[model samples]
Target: MMKIRDVGHAIWDRPLGRIVLLLVGGLVIAVTVMLYPPLRDVVQWFLPLGLIIWGGSRVYLYGRNDLLSLISGCLLILGGITRAVFQLIPLNELAGTVANLIPVVAIFSEMFAHHYREQE
Candidate 1:
């Protein structure tokens, strides 16, 4: 019979095993959050805040040297701020959708610009 410690070590040794474990942990947390109304509300409220932090960090780290990255990161930060503001203001769903799309479109445009510039 294998020892529990050995089994745990075996799981940690494989990349797939680690990924599966991380995914399972995330699923468990997601389900737990969904089960509680208050927790769900808290998560929703903070989600945009998380996005803002992520975007700001990206801008600070990568935007200094690359103008396109700066634009894309700024758009991401704007989208997060717009979402947070709309949550409190009771805006139309279309406004929120547009806000969410800004970062995605900016990123894609930046990528294409970089690709074309490199090809020249």
Candidate 2:
């Protein structure tokens, strides 16, 4: 029988274990979204909005001191606005794709910027 401390040490010691846990969690969420149409729709509409609101709040709180946060937050807010506007308008699929990519690219850019800055 494994002790609680042993289990905690295993989790902390193994990065692969953390990755596996995250993957399993993601799979469960994916399955749930696919099985439930209402949930799928709600996630589709609200997840980006939630990201936008969260990002905007972060910007308001920390943007003054951090340039990367400001840029990322603006990108998130812009992505959300574009997504919402696209939903309202009957536009082409490409526009929708761009709107979706905006936040993802912003996140990646922010991560890269931070990593580069840390190396300096």
CA-lDDT, candidates in order: 0.74, 0.78
Residue 95 local lDDT, model 2: 84
Looking at candidate 1, the ten consecutive residues that score lowest on lDDT are 108-117
* Model 1 lDDT on a 0 to 1 scale: 0.74
Judge candidate 2 at residue 15 and give its lDDT: 94
Task: Identify the candidate with maximal TM-score.
Answer: 2
Runs off by more than 4 Å, candidate 1: 1-26, 106-120
Relative to the unseen true structure, what is the Cα RMSD of model 2? Answer: 3.6
Residue-wise C-alpha lDDT for candidate 2, range 6-84, written one tens digit per residue = 9978986899988887898889988999888678777777856876896787588768977877887787788778777
In model 2, the runs with Cα more than 4 Å from the true position are: 1-13, 113-120
Q: For residues 67-109, write the lDDT of model 1, one tens digit per residue.
A: 7667766766776788778777776779877766765675575
